[model samples]
Target: MSQANPDRPDLDLSSCDKEPIRFPGSIQPHGFLLALSPTLQVLQASDNLDDMIGADAARAIGQSLQAVIGEQAGLQLVPEIDAADIGQRPLYLCTLGIGPARHFDVLAHYYDALLILEFESVARASAADFRHLHRQVGDFLLKLTDTASTRTMSALAAQEIRRVTGFGRVMVYQFDDEGHGHVLAECRADDYPSYLGQRFPASDIPRQARELYMLNRIRLIQDADYTPARLVPALNPVTGKPNDLSFAALRSVSPIHLQYMRNMGTLASMSVSLMVKGKLWGLISCHHATPCTVAFDKRTACEQLGQILSMCIESREDANELQFRLDVRRIMVSMLAGLTQSADFIDNLSSVFPALLKFARAGGAAILFEERLLTYGDTPDEEAIRELVAWLDLHCHGDVFHTDQLAALYPPAAALAANSAGLLAMPVSRIHKHYLLWFRPEVVRTVEWAGNPHDKDGAPPAAQLTPRTSFATWRETITGTSAPWHGGEIELAIEFRSALLGIALERAEQMAELAEELGRANKELEAFSYSVSHDLRAPLRHIVGFSDLLLEPSANENLEKRQRFLRNIKDSARLAGKLVDDLLSFSQMGRAALRPTLIQMDDLVRSCIDKLALDIGARQVEWDIGTLPAMRADPTFVQLALYNLLSNAVKFTSQKERAVITIRASDEGAEWVMSIADNGAGFHMDYVHKLFGVFQRLHRMEDFQGTGIGLANVRRIIERHGGRVWAKGAPGNGATFYFSIPKELNI
Candidate 1:
């Protein structure tokens, strides 16, 4: 195997720079390196150039490049060398050699004012079979579109890559949210042990290695056992440091990685980066049991496949996420409807807690409303959860909050790590301090490492660079963490919070109204007493006077007078009872709980019309029921309000030959405006302010038989549903009652 120094014992990794494997200033002996000045004079040549190219290194140096490689070959390289510049991508030059019939793969790059060239021998058969290689790659690309999922696509890619490269094994590795990787798909010989489903620590591919993969999409080690060829000069004379081989196609393998591969009993390996959205997603890793070399063309084809696979993976993941979001939206609509209809928002949410938990795939959920905490599923005790909420309130920003590693973020969470290792909390109300929280249980799992990671003697020198030698599986039981929360899940949580915020605002408005009502409590009580006395006193007095008259002996004989008084007394008492009943109905409208539903306004209006048929008997009532839209509202309350409006329309239009009562609804941007119009005994516009007030009537009882509380009840019900009510009318003209309800359910 290649080594940085034959005399150096093991490897050392203490210094970040000066790591021998990183700055090897060498290439594998299978290839020779050459450096030329801008004028084409050779400045440096590898020591082994004589063995492979029949050129003495000492003699080649300071000579014209054309004299060393032959006039024709050197002339062909001039244009390529002149085009190259520092940091420029390496260009592939035609294969050529001096005094040898062997085929060489030549590449040229310019760096630090020098044109560097590398040559490695390749099989002539590979070069001649371009058509065959193209056909194979084309077949893979054609089948890629038909792949149904990432896993299936990955498996097909692995198999096709193994076939193209003739590698012993090929694996598709996928990285998780935490940067750890696992073997997602594999294609290997029957005798090869499976690494499928095995997890690899992030340490296996360190940060620097990952960065290199992004820069160089493909890397290859043709012979793990081949000796490394040292550069003629150990450092670039211009830079006074090892040449930046970051973009080099034939850069030497890291010594630590080589030692790792040797321990796995692999002689050759290659890796192609899988990128998605300009980020390194994973890798397509290939391994062989014997020294192997793939031609440049084949490697290029594999790189193309890697890019195709990356796009496929991205598309599949996006498609899946879209479907998931659709499902979430469906659930959210149902939940919102429930919340609007519910008398208490928190109670309704608790009832649908299971669905909420599914939003983030959490193991437990809790709702903190009005200073009370309600928990569901698997959760920590109430007290601990309260503390968690407190912590979140202090630390969390914005309305939605989340973390996969709760223990790491909040120390107190460590105590309940088993139950609340991950948290997704959202504040439903900023003022009321209402919150919704979801938790994921700790997922204790055993991770298998490729080898024993510990030092051999339980201690090692700090600067030692020797990679672990054993390939035995090392098991580690991880705790205090759960499965990570994905970006999609976080987005869903934020959407859910937004929906809840609407409900919270409605609740806040209702509370404000209640506060206002409380401020006027004393005045309302005084008015109630005055109304009771003024409305009920006459009936009681009439009853008493008629009874006293019947007690007179002479009056007992007066049958007509006695009958007249008895009838008058009964009429007054009945009117008094009706008034009391109307008052009670008005009060109940405000206190009754709302059960909102997606209501068909037409059906509701029709039902109300049918109920008012008795009052419209034998009348030529022309019903103009226009197209009505659906609304989210309490069905029972809406029905009651419509009944009152329709009844009033019929009663007031009694004077008309053809009573036209029209019910129609129109979209008014964010709300639906519904109108109930009638050619009735319309009131003056001056009394419009008192139209919906309690006991406020437009006509006398003899004109319209009503307790004058119908309009009041209608106004109350509509306002409770986050709506408004108003009227337009003039004396002797038609009246139109308009009410509007929000398009979206808020309360």
Candidate 2:
């Protein structure tokens, strides 16, 4: 392979003066370079140029340009030179099959009556520099998995390009919601002024410019000040004026663009388009002060780097989507566990996931099935979940399917357009049973996505896309521009979804089994309670009567002995009576149908406190009442719970010189928090574990009254409403009892 000298200064095409060429004459270098004709005698040839055509520069000198480029190359040059400066003209310089697909610009001038031609191959670019650029870009893409934010990714891309290309400045420019662009990332040279965060008028790069960017993807205007080629009119009869060949065909250079670059103190400009799914997402713009020409190889590497960058951005976006969906699923599972209706689950997820993930704007999400489509969030208007379900039902067999494959099934308007990259459908199952669909309205900022850690193939491609118009055709020559997503990542996602669906299905089955067992247990408990109340109670009553009879003849016996016997009978009867009552209450709490109503907790607490008015009035007590939120709960159970908590507090605090009880309430987003605190003789911390257990007490009966079931009863009541109750305190530092109620209980 032939190589150009690395030490050679980059060709300063900026000062190429425009002059009319007299092609049929003397040895004029500039004129020869300007000639559109490929057939001309060569006056001089550099060794590099000679080797490019597999010939020595000495022998190639004085030969016709066509002899070097071949007749086919001469024929392809016709349309390229005749291109008008319009939008419709093909900006591409068509390459013909000369000995090989070699591209070159021909310029000629006559001076001294010896016709001469200058040749500059379009493919000759900074190859080594581009390879370095490709490596840097690869490194940057690898770094994208480290952070999820667009700001960081964009910054990294810009900085890496600046470092590799030695650009004076580099910036990542992204369009806003309104298509107005701003510099999202900037890496400036130390000696150069900063253009970071500087806003440019939208008009500077208008809609047309953006469209051009999407089409071109990369651009390099080496030096803007070259002679403009005359616009050649279209030869064929057409409906409109020949498309502005300026956009299509290569002109020497635009003075306006050159002046603009010079004004920015930039001698060379290079920009690579950051794209997603064929659409322009953003740009990596590099600027250099000195006239610099990027060799062809280097440009190819840069294009490969650009492709890798695009993949990184896309992967990051996918990760964010996964996270958002995960969060929504988590919230929905919580909501559904409470048996909240599916509609309520949807609303709760909408408010939770986007808020946490900052997914700027999401339209809707849904799960699709053959029988029904479970739609939620902001559902799209055109393609309903039902349509997706139908499509999947028809096409699904045991592999993932995208909506694009079902285009025929959907109506013209209903069909998701290819341009709406936001429309996504992923199979929840390989068996075609279900799918997940989501819609997002805006471009997603980059996210940190875990990359495939598997080893990749290292064989690199030959050519790549670049920011120069002359190199556009080179893309077709590249074998692989980017490494595709690894099989592992896609498989991992599939496994994740499978696991999620499996867990959901298993949990539903478990719930069904538990419901059946609970029904049976309730019936048996009810039957046992009835037996104890009627059959067992009658026997205890008879025993007590017989014991009384034994102690009946009070007048005929020793009075002390008779009194002892009578006390024994009375104690036994009372013990039996208490056992029966406890059993009945426990059973009742289980069997009674829950009658949830909107009950203000404050009023309930007050009602419980009313029953203890006489006791409170007798003691020097300070009571602090707090406003409590209303909740959906059984009024009777809530009353019992409050009575138990307050009673325990009052009993413990009764020993203090001045008792202080504070009741406070607050809402904790998803739940209501109520705390009851007291300044009293707090129990030992070691005894806290037994506080809410049945028949467990921290203090003796004489100090806190009988029946160690008070706190336990409170716990049971609170738990029945899917809430939690706990106590916190130090010995003698007073104690606070806290409980939370699920907000969805109101429904």
Candidate 3:
């Protein structure tokens, strides 16, 4: 390492991610660093302090900081330290002059209760330079605010940083969720070799270095080939360990990084971290073909640029996400329409939400929700799916479970490798064992890399840590795994899951409400059934007696009376059977699930008329049917409702010489209102509410031989469809029965 760091000995060296780059014990040689106690007492100093401070670092240690630096410089340190917030990054305190020409910019920060001071040599600069920098930063910020997207902002940032730092090349690149870096925008000299469009493996930065970048915000390497300075007292006296130079601007970098820089032909470089929501979003990396150093004030301006860019980046990302969600909703509507228009959409989606499979880009999808395993498209057998779901339920501890190589995680999945090589499962309900899963088939493809893909693990190539010098394309054949899932796909999956969960919860609430209403209705039905039984039991007994007598020869002595008795028995039995059948159908309607579909009311009404041909046969029924708009509803139940209403019209209008039954439908804003008006035995408007009551006949049984259950069933069916039923009538005039179905209903 360029710096001597007693890095955690317990780190697993096999992986480059475990490197402790943040704990470097020494500082860069171009500058000197001093570690002091909180009270301004010196605890450690760099070995290079001899030429810089005119004293050996070993002797300088254990002495008061006031005696080490001049009393004037010492006095400035106390007040700056007192007014300073130790929690912040390194703060540039003031400039100190050892002589007429020797001056250094002193930066101070607290690390582990120790005051760390970095002394960077200051170059002479005119006042014009400072004003020009301030103007540039101000202009850049204005442009940044006016910028519309991250891409534009990145290009702007790269150009501005290059202009300010005078670097040969500046590149603004971002990291993907997978940690691979891609150069987004670049500003470089003409002679500089283009590194644009280059992709860097995650191992290039390592894990700890990225973390340090987040904590430190900025890092500078004055000379990549410079020697590192050793610390006088290797270990901190206060903590009894190597001083943590995490916040030190002059902290030495790793030898591996220095070598990597040399390999890139970059003599001097500086990087400013672009952070968004505490994450290292990207970097504004500057490189110089020849050795060069930026003034402390100029570097500070670059840091400010990065800070502003982070906020701008977040804003752009948020806007993009909102637009994406809107797009998804629009696409969902289109896909739903296309599916419904298909000849067999319901048949295809008899299992799960198959439409979302388009977003997953998978072979098939499944749902392990509510203990139901439903599969669609190309998928494994039910037994294989159940085992996979069981394994996920037992082992997965997150909101999602994903793997490209399912066989590696679950051995049993290998047998189902044809279509289930990859699986991405997300929970539909956080409180329950409900999950939505997607599948992918095993894919064989070639993976292209800038270097050896095997060395992408961040481990050293050999005994010594070194970077790959080869820029040649490397390709390898990959097998037994599905294409890797991307961030956008996962986000889409989450959105789909959220919408599914919301719909399920809404349906559950509707069901609960319906169940409660059914309970109350059943109770009323029970009481009504008892009353019907009491009224009909006498006729039932008489019918049985009459049938028995007819079979006897003595009872058939009077043939006319025997035929009359038989007629009475037949009428009573017919009424009883009709009542029983109606009651059973009414009871089952509330329990069965609705399989709704897009229904054309016009076709349905015509179909109902065809079925009622027997009832309307040889009758003088003038039917004036009007146009009906298409709607979505349960066809079976709706058909039953239409039949009952039409039958009632036919029965009531039988008295009219030319019975006129007018059937018309009209759009009523929120619902579609259809009226069945007839010039028949119209009742008073005061008794309209009683029309839908079961067995509540307004007319005598002799006048209209009906059970009065038809209208009640119609009311039930309409209400279940999120609609209403009503009637308008006058005594001896005409009655117009109106029933409405909502134009658009989630049900």
Query: Could you report the Cα RMSD, in angstroms, for every candidate shown?
Result: 25.9, 32.7, 26.8
Q: Tell me, by lDDT, which candidate is best.
A: 1
Local lDDT at 493 for model 3: 55
Candidate 1 lDDT, 39-59, residue by residue in tens? 777877777787787878778
Off by over 4 Å in 2: 1-149, 231-259, 336-747
- In order of appearance, the predictions have TM-scores of 0.64, 0.33, 0.57
Best by TM-score: 1
TM-score of 2: 0.33
RMSD of 2: 32.7
- List candidate 3 segments past 4 Å from native: 1-18, 71-88, 125-133, 145-147, 333-450, 453-464, 471-747
Q: List the residue pairs that clash in candidate 3.
A: 2-255
lDDT score of residue 205 within candidate 3: 88
Residue 110, candidate 1: alpha-carbon lDDT: 73
lDDT on C-alpha atoms for all candidate structures: 0.76, 0.52, 0.75
Pairs with steric clashes in candidate 1: 11-465, 11-466, 12-464, 12-465
